[model samples]
Target: MTARDEIPLRDADQVMRLSRMGSFHQSRLSFMRILLRRMRNENWQFDAPDWHVNENGVGRAVYTVHGPSRAYSLVAFAHDLPDEMRSDRVIATAWDTTFTLFDGIPTDDDIARLAQNVPLQEAGRISVRELTLSRANRSARLWDFVVANLSAGRQPDPESLKTVGYVMRTTAVYGSGKFGAADHGTIQDRPEFAAPFQAEMLTVYLIRCFVMDLLDHNAKCAGGKRAVKLSPKLRRALGIGNSTGLGMAPFLVNHPTLLHQWIAARETALARVRGIKTVTDGERDVMIHHAKSAHINAMNWHSQHPMQIAKVTELQSDMVMLCKEITRIGDAPYPWDRLYRWAAQNLTSEGLEQVVSILMEPYGDVVDDLADAMSIDESAHFYIDGTQAMGHVKSLIAKHFDWALKTDFGAGDEQARFWYVSAAKLEPRLGERDAEQGHELEQPLAIGRDVAALYRAITQDETVAHFLRKHPEHRHILRRVQMVEKFPYAEIRDNLLHAQMMPIDMLRCKLSFFGATHFDPRSDRWLRICMFQNAPFPDELYVPGNWVYPEPTGAI
Candidate 1:
């Protein structure tokens, strides 16, 4: 048996705490890396057959990716959105750019139809032929700076590029039957999209291409004959940015089975890498290079939020200590495991997670296969097992949700926050239990409180069938308890309703698996992040690439 097979996965209690989940960093198991690796291995072909934008930057572009058995196209519409109409709220009626991922290469008829409706956003309707619907706004400050500099035949200052990280930030990217788009089941069978969010990832990837093309187009329009395109190096340095808010926090709670699969794949990958008995000099060098690169990423990551600012500062310091410690470790048995143990003892949560991320970079052969197991058939766990005895259910709840059962929801502080959907926007919003009008309409996001309630109600020994027959209100929570019994890493062991709960933690956990970086939380409820920020573009996928954290900007 392999050393990895002998090493057990980390306990759910340790892995699923909100604080630790919030500190998660992207690893080889991240969906973005998995998608890119597959595309590269399969030798997918890409092309932009249409690019028709005017001097005013109002036009359409189509980027298509042709896999072995199918093709998908990103149809983008650029608008002359005045500064006043540009807002990030879902209620906003207009945006600088809108996009839809077409099931295949779109025709002139499809583009015309989309041009009329895609720009309308939520107000407009998309057909089932669309796989994903999305929109973005240019980074007003950096967009002009980059365009002006490139128009003047010079590259924008790299420091400014690093500060912003991406020229355009997406407001939303909807998939899985949202807004009339083709449901995930339509294309889930394709090998290219067997993993979760592959279509969404592909949409964002093509959107990055469109953003770059649009920037260059506008720069040339402004500079005329003197305009220069962004340098290849500078271009690759930019990624697609996203603004995520409370609407995403519920996803983790609502999709526990899938969550377990994702966390399991990553933790399993870490254990596999940790179990390596010895590392060659070449492997050590690769790990060192990635470590240095991650340090560069830490140095460049800028955030205005106070908590994130402190994290960035601590991470920068941690990287320095990491460099010093890397030199001290000598050739020995289970060297990778030894390093992990050292990190657990010496590094901050943020820094330790970063350490775990880089460690997996050099062992792709050991961990890449875990990507295939990250998707789950959630429906398989949907039906409640009525045969389970009440005592057995209580035991399962006590084991998986001991933290939940301990929460004192009677205290106002413990139930200070409530999640509800906004009537104006119909999206998730966090409201104060004491001050907001919607506390009575709260969603069942307070899983911990509900579990505690269930524990109290099931004081006597009876079958789950009897309890459910008497009180159907507890059925949902009962199903969850039964499900968690099998899926170890399924529950977030924090009080979501607590006044101190950071919804950003939930957002960060999900985004980390998407391979995002430069998490700049604007508020506790929402944050900004960059995707594929040092990743290779579709055109560059054919070339040997090292698009990992802390890219090798010559100065670094």
Candidate 2:
């Protein structure tokens, strides 16, 4: 039985709102949703193999997962290290441990071969079979406590989750042909894995379970006959921790079409929910219920980032007032639409958008319908449409991208910096246009200033093909202009060259929809996040899909 056959359409203006997008809450549209969906539908199975660790949880481990259509394994390499090696930054080479998500179940040879390559990361070359690659360091705060408690056959105190939530914090999860790994093109169409980041997600999902088993194994090794397997409930408490900084900021800008598709799908889902002329009384009740669950989740969301803290405050307050109206106007006309209006006025940018996100849950039939289209082949459309006329490009820039023009950019503050790729790890970094020296090697990601320049330059040409022939160097932005002709919200209008560029807003816009809670901004550049905070464990996969709304404690 195939689900998700319908596509929801959103209001373009509402979807394009910058602040609203930054405020987007997770919904059925999140990657975690798809991962859980596929896991249940396919009935994927996992098994533990050789868990060679001392009582201290040090050594190699291998676990394999059998999906509906294929087999892959997670090979975790653990090493003892001093405390100083625990940094989550990209430059740090030595970690407490390293892990690789391999393409298939490994033979003894394959495991030995991986032992030679996976740890070296960029330095040691890998073959095509290494599907999704990543590395993580243990959370010093929680790892020892978890192993210690489990060894004694006791659950770790729940309060430990408040400060540091996850066991293994992934530094980076690399996929799609990075570092000699096979691209998604290699096997994305296999019945089991078809979406963007699906392979990477599979790695993280299995790793979540592996963290539990790995810790359990270490406990057993320590306790000999006394080591206790983790209780099912406590195992569910573990989530895969990801320490992401500004590195993700580039993808949102570089893949403008994909970004537009994601936001558009989210908006379309929201609009579709609002457009439902008549839903069952049960359905209306479900919406009110989930809206309250989202509110509770928002209340527990702990983030010190002033902007995010302010948004959380608004979301909590708005939910209190909004839920009252939802109950009072039980049979009200245009309930969804009216709620949206109330939110737009009363809620913060993130809060209002978060409401739009949670509203999609009651109408899963609508959001799920749009899931297949969420994945995009960015490489397919990299080339500019030379056949397009300059007049068409001009009209596209003028009509769809006026936001890029309206900004007062290129001033001393506005143009204070340029975005460049860090040579050490090949990650994105921001440097001053004047204060920093390496502006010459800038990556072609700044869309606002360059698109404005393209708008001006196109006027001098008769045809876009002629213009491209004259200056093929600006082909990237030219392709983007053509893409935006159809995808209006494709380009974020913020000028990357400016000092005031809020990269956190860009990250928040993407991560929020991923169902991530607690946006801890370590700095404007990078931060920490917790996923599946109130989410259910894998055993609950066969339960109803609406579990995202229900608290783990069974409230709402």
Q: Residues 385-452, candidate 1, lDDT per residue (tens digit)?
A: 88778888888888888988777799989999999999987889999999879788888888999888
User: What would the per-residue lDDT of candidate 2 be over residues 108-175, giving only the tens digit for each residue?
Assistant: 89889888877776666667988867787888768888878878877788767655667778888888
Pairs that clash in candidate 2:
10-268, 23-350, 245-526, 414-498
- Identify the runs in model 2 with alpha carbons over 4 angstroms from their true place: 1-14, 223-229, 534-536, 545-556
Each candidate: RMSD: 1.6, 2.9
Q: What TM-score fits each model?
A: 0.97, 0.92
User: What pairs collide in candidate 1?
Assistant: none
The lDDT, on a scale of 0 to 1, for candidate 1 is: 0.88
Name the regions of candidate 1 deviating beyond 4 angstroms: 1-5, 553-556
**Model 1 lDDT at residue 472:** 94
**Top candidate, metric TM-score:** 1
